[model samples]
Target: MPGNMVTSEFLVDVDHQRCRRCKRCILNCGFGVFDFQSMTTADSSKCVACHRCVVFCPEEAITIRRNPLAFREHSSWDVDKRKAVWKQAQSPGMILTGMGNDLPWLNVFDHLLIDACQVTNPSIDPLREPMELRTFLGRKPDRVEVVPSDGGYRVQNPPENNIELDIPLIFSGMSYGSVSLNVHKALAIAAEKLGTVMNTGEGGLHQELYPYRDHIIVQCASGRFGVHSDYLNAGVAVEIKIGQGAKPGIGGHLPGEKIGREVSGTRMIPVGTDALSPAPHHDIYSIEDLRQLIYALKEATGYKPISVKIATVHNVAAIASGIARAGADIIYLDGFRGGTGASPAVIRDHVGIPVEIAVAVVDAQLRSEGIRNWVSIIAAGGVRSSADVAKAIALGADAVGVGTAALIAMGCRLCQKCYTGNCSWGIATQKPELVGRLDPDWAAERLVNLVNSWSLELKEVLGALGVNAIESLRGNRERLRSLGLDAATTEIIDVKPAGR
Candidate 1:
């Protein structure tokens, strides 16, 4: 026997009395845990606890549980750390993980509390009052020049190009090869229905999505995958992806196993080849280089709104200021808790800061520099609920971007096995059999319901705060108080103590 054998994490049990031997569990499970020779048998070692079999069993015969056998308890070397070491011992390479960081770190949004109207101020009822959630994302001129027209006054200088959203929510980017085509179709349909925008990650836009071009934000990343003159002008806006929060300061790699004919055609790469994006854009080494690209994109796209996306780092405020000066109409800050198709375990859990702090610092810096109106800020990563949306606006974000939450509405169970390409839920897999499990129309309806529910909840939150419009809450930190937070943290987020 070999030393340091990796113990199974999940235990799968089969009840013969309840099981009909219909072989449904074998067909439903993508991880290949169930088999039948004489009777139904389960290989507990292969289970990832995805719950597909348990949910699909006709007789409810399958049960999955955590393995009771665990390593000797230790405070520093936890179960995950020990298991990781054991796995690396067998196949030595960088460890890869999917979804967001699963580490037990502090979530800043949980500590911050929103203030409501009390005795002095009267709260408005959302059902009775009109609450505005419409948001325009783009640059705004500091001053507008108006001239007298035949009927009235006309603005000689109009505002910069902007995209209007019915709700202050956007679907974050999840690439084509990383996720199934049905997932992309659902997101596009939902964005069109919600009157918002959806990002097409680094992967180029599939031809089927061309019809929804007016509601899309095409991305131009380090690899420049699928970028062309037609693709640049196809969307309402363009996003220049500098870095993603999950793996900051590193490149992206989509393994050859996931790249099929459709993905190859869309990304303009050959089939069965790994799609690798360099760590940094070769043409962009300085702020000046970024400015050139920004202008080049603008000149190519008839001066459409341009957004620059960056991972939230310690010096994010300074970096955002430079991006604003580089003529970007929007700044997208992705925090540490963002999701990804695949990323190194070390970077996803340890790198990047939270979006809350990034939003506060960037907004404050731009305001201090007298350029707050120069660009709109979109804060992404770790946004989970409607309350988080309201708090993000209060912390100075013009809008919030959501990724993992949308997937959960479409039946994702947070299994954290997205990188394996065996997603039973069909949200992260490229195989035809798994991808067919999800229907775009059904998934789109679920996503539409999710956003509509959040929109209503946001209006209720606004009514409780005695604000009829969401714009009133923008950058208003006085309405927030920090609880169970240190003095330094509260100061950094610009929130007062709970009592005060």
Candidate 2:
């Protein structure tokens, strides 16, 4: 097999006349695409189009674009397929990838439209009237009990262990080893600032971030990395990560090279050793078994709201129902398009179902079972904009999680090179030099701004829908309509077709 069988995926052009010999591009790029001996030279084959050089070059002399090299066009045997075959032949191994699925599947959210108030119902102006975005995550009782007070009746019972959010959005879990500590700090700061929560993935919470414990959701993965009594009690809520949407039925491996001193310390693993998480919790084979862990964490955390996270699959609705019945206060549904630090390319692109469908089915199933109030649904994966957040809430999600979008707000370019442990923007890599590039304070500000803008947009959405609060939109399928969606999809989503 020839080593050069795979063609370069990108073309890098550096105009010498405009190049100032500053060497900033070479310094900024984590990938070794540029070399400057006397004059600057580029290895186009090595470029991943991260745009580090293009952005850092003071003279703006660099341009990175897709290679124009053409291959025979075929419906099935596309360029990517051909390239993968060639690369595998040269070096046989499972093809690892990063980020979310990039396939061109139809996004269900795009086909679904939110209905606005007209004629019969009057719309509320968010600017003039109060619009409530505040939401709580926890199990709710069927009814509340009240006793007579001095002046008015007061509620004798209130929901226990509920996590309040000003914006009904969570910063999804991205472990320490998978992403830089600066990213975690930024998320924590932003969550605290915005009155929401940030999840401390399978990686244990770093000691430095303990100050933000009130705004965190600590995870207990199959490997139980960094999980202890202190770790569990540190967060307002605890999450058992049964599966991630990026690679549904597989284990996760954080390469030894990326496990630095801090990562090792936080995860409680030896430095330079690969951190592995088994596909399923060893102790959980059935719903009964899952129930045991959920309660155990609840016990460990003094009965804090327990969350069970699972990947969205064909039977996600059933799985979510089981989780709720098993005493989980929150059911986190991660869709196929969720981002990850490392995942097999084959699994990331092909395995799980879309989150939009999962949210609809799960919400409907839980409602039918009369267990909807038993667990708060947090939908994730492929949530790109404010419209997505609104659609998710309307589809029955109590709150939504944003992973890739948060990273992008923190300067991620979606270059899909995170698994390489050489992130130029400092959002993914643990390397000291690379990590130093990111300022947590600045990144936190960016995140705060992003969420604030989204919250404002959500209010606009609520006002247009003639609702004064986000609570009214929860599982209100009547406020939604399908556009160009097939009958089956429309029915499954429980939204009427346009003009119906």
Best by TM-score: 2
Write the residue-wise lDDT of candidate 2 on 332-429 in tens digits.
Answer: 99999999999999999999999999999999999999889899999999999999999998999999999999999988889899999999999889
Give the alpha carbon lDDT tens digit for every residue of 123-177 in model 1.
9999998999999999888988899999899999777588999999999988998
- Name model 1 segments beyond 4 Å from true: 144-158
Candidate 1 weakest ten by summed lDDT:
1-10
Report the alpha-carbon TM-score of model 2 versus the true structure.
Answer: 0.99
Clashing pairs counted in every model: 0, 0
lDDT on C-alpha atoms for all candidate structures = 0.93, 0.93
lDDT of candidate 2? Answer: 0.93
| Worst 10-residue lDDT window, candidate 2 | 1-10
Model 2 misplaced regions, further than 4 Å:
147-151
